[model samples]
Target: MRGGFARPVISLQHAPDLHSLRALLALLALVALSGCSLFREPPAPEPVEAPIAASEAEPAASEPEAASAPEAASEPAETPGAKPAPKKPRPPLIRRHKPAPPPPVAASAPPAPPPAPLVQTHTLERGTFRTLLDSEVRKPDGKVVGRAVDMVAGPGGKPQEVVVNLQGFMGVGDRKANFPWSAVHINTPAKTPAITLALTPAQLQTPERPKSGAPQPGSPEAGPTRLPMLDANVERANGAKVGRVVDVLLGGSADPLAVVLDVSGTLEKRRTIAADWSALHFVTKNNALEAQLEMSDQQIDASPAYANDLPVRAVSPAAPPATPAAPAAPAAPAVPAHGDQ
Candidate 1:
């Protein structure tokens, strides 16, 4: 039995040692649990770290995107205003003006014609003698010899006698001679009334003057020097009537200045006058008692004589001769003298 008891003791001792070992193992396990609890590794630590790094990277990246979005929105707002700037308008165009033209021109005109000639005449009127004539005969060497002293009408009231007086000689004898009215020449240019004659200085000097009642041969008192009944009448080339002879105007050159004559039938009638020098014709058979005029009546009226009469004595002595005198005197009177009963 003892042996059996000892073996049981030994076994009991081994069992106590085994119990201490178990106690140590339990303590170590407790310490390990405490350390694990105090310094514990987080659940999924690498995954958590990865998530934090991703969050930081996402903020950085999102910051750039936010700034870019705002810039893009502002760019769109500016585009609308920029579009209106290009559409702004410009100014209008201008034009210029012009002027008008002028008018046309005109033409010119034409010319005119000429005038006619003049003439003179003589006639008888009242008891006092007078003459009618023109101005042309007053020039030097003119045909009319002297102014008519008296103009007497014939029985039918026609011009009958012309008495002409030759002047300038001292009355050595009778310087007066009588001419029939028919012998007077009317000068248009002379502007005077006068008689033209064929008698030269010799014939003019031979006439005898009679005392008032004494009968000189061929005189009115003794029926001497009776004028022949002349069929020819004193007339103008222009056909006007001539009246009566009055006086002559004489100038320095011995040329007849003018012959003064009276118009017939009326007082205050304009007297006819002529230049004695221009007398062209004297109606006489001998041609010795005749002078012709240069101008016609139309020419006389148109001449300066028509405006005013020229002075016969005012003619210069040195003036050239116009017409020459006849070379010889006539032989005898062509008409026969009537008997002095």
Candidate 2:
């Protein structure tokens, strides 16, 4: 009986064993279910209702996490029968600036007229040319006609005529003829100095003899007016002979400006002086001609002296020497001023 009771007890223990095995089987199944849920991939997201372009798609949730994710590439869909949008006008590769207007072209001016030619003239003073005195009057063919004796002056000492002495055989038919100075040409600087006459010798001779003590007809001078210029007497107002007229200086008009005088005895110093033509008065005294000065003999001595080697200096207007004021009567000799005689 004790053995039988131990067997039943064993059986009871065995029954609890089946219960534990069942429990273990249920736990293994639960474990298997959990593992499947944990390893299973999630269901795919629902398909989107409308597709979006790559430009309009939302950005990835996390840049760092999704950086390696490949982006979906979608081509734009083209609708049939729809014209493609016109391509935008392309900007020019190189822009150009408006060219500046060309500079204004100046009109060419007319060339200036050629300038007029310049002419130069030189005027010489008198006394610079050789005196035509005693110069042989000749024709153009070198034939001597006569000798020029003197020149007769008109008013203002203008030498209007020249006296020609035609010497005949032994001075027998020697006659004088007065020709206008203009008709005579003097060339003293030539190799053979001569006075050229425009006319031949036949034109100068006359059949009629000139009256005594008279000038030839049509001569610048008549009667006693024909006097030689050189060695003519120059006297002072007091009738005292002062000097002789040695030269007659002519001007541009060939009129005598001044007469150079040889004032030899008129002053202590033997020199010359130029007297203005106006200072001289020509008169015929006793049928003789003389130039009289408006000054006295003493006044002529006070004039300036001149030299032929130097340029001429005209005589200045004579001014009287100032008389010294008489000394104040010697102060009455201080007649004995009281205390001291």
Candidate 3:
């Protein structure tokens, strides 16, 4: 009996120890459930991405094109049919011009007429000659019949007679007739020295000569009265001064042909002498005669009359020496005999 009691007791101790161990194990399981509530369980990790290669990186950069699409969509639209700008206007062109014409001419005037003749301005001096002769005689028909030959003055210095010679039968048997000075009229205007007669040619042919015893008054024999010679200076037509009258030249015994004048001055310086009757023109106012010839010193020296006998006499302050008479020639010596010893 005692041995059985000891064995039951040993069995009870062993059962209590086993119950304590089972309680400790239940507490450990409750702690594990609370940890699961505090920390969630990690999902299975997504498959890890791989790093891209350089060649494959282009696709990743192209992914930004989706962000640029919204900016392009925000741009404004363009309008249609807008006009082009107008061109600048051009400037206008100017026109050119031409010149004009001249004026017309006027009319001219007419002309005029001519003039007349003049008279000679010379006069004949008085008393230089006793008888005056007409150089020519003309008929009524203007024919020259004869020239005056000689003229004679009466006792009282009057022209008493005029002689004229007529040519008959070709100058043979010439007839000389005496006429009264009253019947002869001087024609100074004729080209030749001429005279006009109131009587016809027949009357001149039968002219009656003046009788010596007839009463001279109221008769054809009555002579021309004498006129005095001018005592004034005489100038030659060439303007030479003639001082005095030396002589007169006459065609016949009683007719006056030309005038001789003496120029006053020195003897070596010869005097002027002129013979042209046409050159004789009397200046009554100056008491001078005018000669028309232009005479030179050589011409005056060569003159026939002046060269031989100088008309001018030199007036010296003192008397000139008397010319001595030439001694008579000695009688020729007796001629010696040809056989003289």
1-341: candidate 2 lDDT, tens digit per residue: 11111111234455668777677667766666776677677986744446655788666677433323332333233458887655546555554699999999999999998743221112233344334457677777777767776677644344678777776777788667777777766563535545677775676654477779965654433335555676677776668886787765544343456677887763466677777666677776667555677655555566666554555555533545469987775555546768885
Task: Give one digit per residue, the lDDT tens place, for model 1 in 174-220.
Answer: 33344544444443323343334544456444355667786553322
Q: What is the lDDT of residue 322 in candidate 3?
A: 59
lDDT of each: 0.38, 0.61, 0.44
- Cα distance off (Å), candidate 1, residue 174: 12
- In model 3, what are the clashing residue pairs, if there are any? 126-228, 126-229, 234-289, 235-289, 236-290, 236-291, 237-290, 237-291, 237-292, 238-291
RMSD of 1: 32.3
Q: TM-score, each model?
A: 0.26, 0.40, 0.26
Better of 2 and 3 by TM-score: 2
Report the number of clashing residue pairs per model: 70, 0, 10
**Comparison by lDDT, 1 against 2, better one:** 2
What is the overall TM-score of model 2 with all chains considered together?
A: 0.40
Model 3 TM = 0.26
Name every residue pair that clashes in candidate 2: none
How good is model 1 by TM-score? 0.26
| Candidate 3 lDDT, 82-105, residue by residue in tens | 654444455444444655555556
